[model samples]
Target: MRVHKLTFAALAVAASLPLAACQSSGGGKGQSDPSSAAASTAPSPSDSKASDAKSPAGQGTAAATGSPANGKVDKCRTDELEITAKDNTIDGDPDGTVAVQLKNRGSRDCTMSGYAGVDLKTNSGPVSAKRSGEQAGPAVLKPGKSVAFGINYPVNNSGGSGVRITGLLVTPPDETKSVTLDWPGAATLPVTESPGTPVKVGPIGSAGQGG
Candidate 1:
């Protein structure tokens, strides 16, 4: 009976050794590979931080480009300019012209471009003159600089039987306010009308170049 019991114990121990060896070999081949573990969990905290840091910096750069102060100049104001008027009529030409000038009285440079608004006052009402001739480019008026424009109008020839001149309301180019000045046209021949005569205004330019 003792020899039988020793033989059964020997068989059980031999069978259990092969099963333990198979489990160890399976663990090594399936899940315990160092290359697989490293590839699956390779993303470090530094990798996430490096990608996340660029977003805020890119947004800050985009916000800085939207600002609008790139050193552009502004238009001239009426209060900063002193206006004057004089007759500049040519004798040979049928039409007569009055030169309206604007001098910058301010301390800094300002832009004056386009036509001046002119209205001739009569006993009936104000006659708005239409703009004529070529448009001048933007003229930068420095401190104490002056620019002039012309108001070419019809002349009275039939013994003062047309519109009598009183005063003129002149608005500078791109300005809101206006100044009142005496009529600079001839007093002898006030502004008269022929069959197809119209009052014309010129662009703002240097001195006599306005017409």
Candidate 2:
């Protein structure tokens, strides 16, 4: 009887050893590694984005859109401006300058940069003017204030018969709308009958400054 009991006790001890080995391997599996857990919850650089800022020192919407970050003015629009051509003599043109004046007729201050779109309306359709001059700086137009640009035409200096301009079509910078003004008799452009476009215009500048 004693020998049989000893054999059963030895078998039971061996069986318990395997169960403890299995438990040791599985015990820590339920817990996650601290390093891996931190990585999963952290934000990645690609997921980050910049929010819209106001502008000025190269930060906001103004810098992106080429406007001053001041946010106080906007590009001058067509409906709020009054355009008129002046004879070289009327506005004191420097020798052979053709100038047109643009006045801010709106109640708010307006701003403009770069070139104004210019076209010479004639009996032979429209003649688009080429842009010239150094890059223009921004011009802020106060209520009732004015600005101007010049037209440099390939004048028929040979004094031959040339194309006649009937009117003017002018558009403010960065605007699609346009305004038509009567071609001033003093602001005459006598282009040659040459094939290539010989007309050029200048950037928005002080009236009568050759743009």
Candidate 3:
């Protein structure tokens, strides 16, 4: 009876050893590795720095894309303007004067600076005018607004004995084509047979009534 009890006791001890081994292996699996756990929980230094850097760069790019306040405006075209002239003569002086008006007929605003080109025209040919030494203020013409300049010349009985001016050819600054304005009346610009330097043109101004 004693020998049989010893064999049973040994078999019980062997079964307990296998259970202990299994418990030890399962204990390691329950706790996670320290390095792997930290990697999963926190972002890397490089990744954090990259995220911070991208934010301000994106903001700066957005700011640069906005439009500027003082942008450049476009120049005036010939088809967008209207030209008119009137005789501005003095009673006693033989020096004749014509006030030329430039109206902006288009939809937008335009800039005009410096002197306009002027010439006296007849059936024979064109006589060029000299630019005066005077400088006028810049003109910004909105729609339907107008500017003016002056053209001064001698009358028929003056130094130009036979000079006759049938028409006036006016070219705006920075324009290729010119507009022709007929003489308002015979008294406005007296017809002379002899022609010299028939005219001298002045700078442009905002007030059309004065030079």
For all candidates in order, the CA lDDT equals 0.81, 0.74, 0.77
**Ordered list by TM-score, greatest first:** 1, 3, 2
Screening candidate 2 with a backbone cut-off below 3 angstroms (N, C-alpha, C), the clashing residue pairs are 55-60
Model 1: what TM-score?
Answer: 0.61
Off by over 4 Å in 3: 1-69, 158-161, 185-196, 206-211
How well does each candidate superpose onto the true structure, as a TM-score? Answer: 0.61, 0.57, 0.60
Q: Pick the candidate with the highest lDDT.
A: 1
User: Which tens-of-lDDT digit does each residue in 1-211 have in candidate 1?
Assistant: 9999999999999999999999999888777678888988898888879878998889989998986577676788999988999989888878788989888889988897889899888775787888886858988888888889888887777675577778889998777799999997955335444543367888888345321
True lDDT of residue 209, candidate 2 = 28
Alpha carbon deviation, residue 153, candidate 2 (Å):
1.3
- Please give the ranking of all candidate structures by lDDT, highest first, separated by commas: 1, 3, 2
RMSD of each: 8.3, 12.2, 6.3
Model with the higher TM-score, candidate 1 or 3: 1
Comparison by lDDT, 1 against 3, better one: 1
